[model samples]
Target: MAKAYWVATYRSVTDPDKLAAYAKLSGPAINAAGGRILARGLPSQVYELGLEQRTVLIEFDSVEQARAAHDSSAYQEALALLEGGAERDIRIIEGI
Candidate 1:
């Protein structure tokens, strides 16, 4: 099975406190679902796009694993914590 990559490009943050709260739950949530965070908050030099923000990348065994990881109860708990914490654009892409 092809590995799946989860990417989240952040735009803006509203509440730092909530972000902290979400962070507290993220690791356990992913690990429990067999997902491992490859890199997070890494800087990207985009000379083409001419803009940048925090980009988070995670790797999963498969698309099903990726989706399952994000849809799990623990992740949902984290999501609930981050409800208004930040503004983000998130997606899961299958890696070639």
Candidate 2:
């Protein structure tokens, strides 16, 4: 199976504390589920019609593993902490 990637774009961040908490908890959860952070940072540049947003890319061994990471209890806890703290667009895609 092709690898899977978790792509997340932070549209807005309202609570830095919650964001920090989520990051701390989610890291170990993702690692336990076989996910690796590929890239994470504010976009260095944007093209036409682009909106400024922080982007994150995480790779997983497979689509199933990616899904598992998202559904894991540790990640879920982080998600709860992040609720209403930010607006984010997150997805998992199969790598080519």
Candidate 3:
């Protein structure tokens, strides 16, 4: 199976404290589910339509694994903490 990459790009953050709280729990939850964090935080540089925003990348063994992690109860809890905190675009991409 192809490896899967989970990506999250933050468009805007309205509540820093809430986002911080979500991060604290989400990190552990994702790690426990066999997701390896590849990169996170603001981009070093931006070009074209890209904006200087926070981005996160995580790797999983397969698409199934990535979906499972996202659907897991632990991750759900973490997600709940992020509600109304920020606007983000998230997706899972299969590796080449």
In model 1, the clashing pairs are none
Best by TM-score: 3
Taking the tens digit of each residue's C-alpha lDDT, what string does model 3 give over 1-96? 899999999999999999999999999999999999999999999999999989999999999999999999999999999999999999999999
Residue 92 shift from truth in candidate 3, angstroms: 0.3
lDDT of each: 0.86, 0.92, 0.97
Give the 10-residue window scoring lowest on summed lDDT in candidate 2. 24-33
Q: Tens-digit lDDT track for model 1 on 1-96?
A: 799998988888789899889989987898889888888874756777644777788889999999999999999999899898799988999989
Model 1 lDDT-worst window of ten: 42-51
Arrange candidates, best lDDT first: 3, 2, 1
* Candidate 3 deviant stretches above 4 angstroms: none
Compared with the true structure, model 1 gives a TM-score of 0.92
Q: After aligning candidate 1 to the native by TM-score, how far in Å is the CA of 28 from where it should be?
A: 1.1
